[model samples]
Target: MNRIYLPLAASLVLIVSLALVEGKMRDRWGTPGVEAAELGKRFDQVPKKIGDWVGEDLPVEEVTRKTAGAVNYVSRLYTNSKNRNTVNLWLIIGHSRDVCRHTPTVCYPSQGFRQTGDPLKHHIDVLGEEPAEFFTATFSKEDPSGRHLERVFWAWNHPNTDIWEAPDNARVHYGLSRALYKLYFVGNVLNDENTIDSSASVDFAKLMLPALNAALFPEKIADTVQSDIQPAGDAPAEEVPAE
Candidate 1:
C-alpha cells in the first residue's frame, strides 16, 4: 500500500510542476514586445524602385496582419522593366520569432495550392553580401480558369545576424528575441515548359536584399560605413534613425 501511494504522489507532484512552468512561459510570451504603431516608418523606408524593377505597394488584409502578429509588414508587386518578370514580395516584421509560424509550407496549402515537393534549402547569395539561407518550393493549383504554378522563396532574419535563415534555425536562435523579420517572394508565372520560373525571384532578391538590409539593420549599416570611411577625405554618412 505505501509503495503504490508513493508513485502516485510523485506523479502528481511532477504534473503540477510542469503545469506551473508552462503557465510562466505563456505569461512571458503574452507580454507585448513590439507594437505595430511603433513601426510607422517601416513602409516609407522601402524604396519603390531597386535597379530596374519598379515596386507598387500591395494591400495586406488587417485580419492577416493580426493573425501573424506583425509589428510591421510590406506587400509589394515588383515588375522588371526589361523582361517584364513579376514577383510579389512580402516582408513581415514581428516582435517575436513566432511570426515565422505561418510559412508558405503551411499557408499556401491552406489557400488551395498543392505543394509539388519538399522544400529545398538554398544558400542564396546576393550581389553585394554574404550568402543567406532560404527555403524554396514550387506550388501548383487549379482554378475555374486554368492551372497555375507559383515558385515561393522564404527566409527569416534572426536576431543574431542580418542574413536570413531557415525556420528551424530561426526559431532556435530567435525564439525569444525582441524582433524578427520574414521575407517572401512569390513568382506567379510558369515558363514555356510549365515549370515555375525562379529567375525573376532570384534576380529581384539580388537587387532588393541590400535595400532590405539598410531598412532592417540601419545601425549595422552605419557601423560598417563608418569603419570603411577613408581618413583622407571622406566623412561618415549620417546615421539612419530607428524606432
Candidate 2:
C-alpha cells in the first residue's frame, strides 16, 4: 500500500508540473500587442508597379477571408509588360497560429490539387540586404477546364524585425508574435521539367523585395550602398613646385 501510494503521488506531481510549464509558455509567447489596422494600411502601400510587372487587384470573398483569419490581405495578379508572363501575389497579416496552419501542403490537397513533389527551400538575394528564404512547391489538378499546374513560393515575416523566414515549423517559431505576415508568390507552371530559376515568380520576387522593404519598413530604410568615397584623413599635401 505504501509503494502504490508513493507512485501515484509522484505521477500526479509530474502532471501538475507539466501544466504549469505550459501555462507559463503560453503567457510569454501567446499574446503581443499588434495593431491590425495600421498593418492593413501598410499592406496597401506596396506598389502596384514593381519594375516591369504591373498589378491589378483580385477580389477575395469575405467568407474566405474570415476562414483564413486574415486581419488584412492583398490578392493581386501581376503581369510582366515585356513577356506577358504573370504571377499572383497573396500577402496577409493575422495571428501567427491561424496564418501558419494554412500552408500549401495542407490547403492544396484539400482543393483536389496533388503535390508534384516535396517542397524545397529556395533563397532569393534581396538587393542591399540579406537574402530571403522561401518554400517552393508545385501542384496540379485535372478538371473539365483542363489540367492546371501551379508553382508557389511562400514565407513568413515578423512585423518587428521585418525579416522573412521560412521555418520548418512556423507556428512554433512565430507563436510568440501576436500577428504575423505570410506572403505567397504563385505562377502557372508551363513545364514541369523546366527549372524554376527563370520562372516569372522568381524574377518578380527579386524585383519586388526592395519595394516591399520600403513599404513595410519605411522607418528602417537606409542607403546601404556606398558610392565613390575618399578615405577619411587630412587632405593630401598640395603639389609643390619642388623637384
Candidate 3:
C-alpha cells in the first residue's frame, strides 16, 4: 500500500505542475478564439498562432481593436460661413499601432507612440454626432512657453491634401527645424494663448468658396468672380440724324 500510494502522489504532483505551466503559456501567448464558421481542427490554429510572431512567439501580446480607444477633433474653415470649410470631425483613434486616422476625411498621419507625440492622443476624445461650435485642442504636456511642441492650427490651414509635393498631407509634421521660426510655430501660439484653441474655428474667409459645379451654384461664381455686364447705349439712336 505504501508503494502504490507513493507512485500515485508523484503522478498527481506532476499533473498539477503541467497544468500550471500550460496556464502560464496561455496567458503569455493568448489563446485565440475562432469564429463559429471555422469550427473544426482548424479552430485550434488561431489560438496556437495568436501571439506567435512570424515563427516564434513575440515578447508582447498582439494588440487588437479591443485594446484601442478613439477621440475626435473638429478643425474649422477660417473662410466662408455660407460655404464654411470644416474638417470631417477628425478622429484620433489610438491603437497599438502608432498612427492617426479619420474615416470620412480619409486622411491619416503616421504618428508615433503616445509617449513622444501629441498629448491629445490620451487626453482628448472624439466629438459626438451632436453639433458643436468649438474644437477641443489642448497641449498641456507641451512647454507652457509654447517653444517645444506644435499646435493643430497648422493642420487646419495646410492639410495633408497639399496640392504640392507633400503626398502625406494628412500627417502634420511638427518638425521644429523649418516650422520653428514661422508664425504658426509654437512660439506664436504662446504669445497669444487666448486664441490658441479657437484659431482654427475662426471665420477668416473673405468670401465663400465657389460652389461646386456651375450647374449647382449657377452663375454665383460669375457674380463673385466676373464683373456685372453693362448694357450698351440704345442703338446709335440719333447718330444718323447728326450726320
TM-score of each: 0.77, 0.78, 0.21
lDDT of 3 by residue, 146-177 (tens): 33322432222112121111113323342211
The alpha-carbon lDDT assigned to residue 200 of candidate 3 equals 25
Per-residue lDDT tens digits for candidate 2, residues 164-239, read 8899988889875557788999999765337877777988999998788788777766433222344567559788
> Which of the two, 2 or 3, has more TM-score?
2
Query: Which residue window of length 10 is worst by lDDT in model 2?
Result: 222-231
Question: Which stretches of model 1 miss by more than 4 angstroms?
Answer: 1-31, 35-40, 167-170, 192-198, 230-243
- Candidate ranking under lDDT, highest first, comes to 2, 1, 3
Which 10 consecutive residues of model 1 have the lowest summed lDDT? 189-198
The local distance difference test score of each candidate is 0.76, 0.83, 0.26
In angstroms, the error of model 1 at 215 is: 1.4
Give residue 155's lDDT in candidate 3 (0 to 100): 22
lDDT of model 2, residue 93: 84
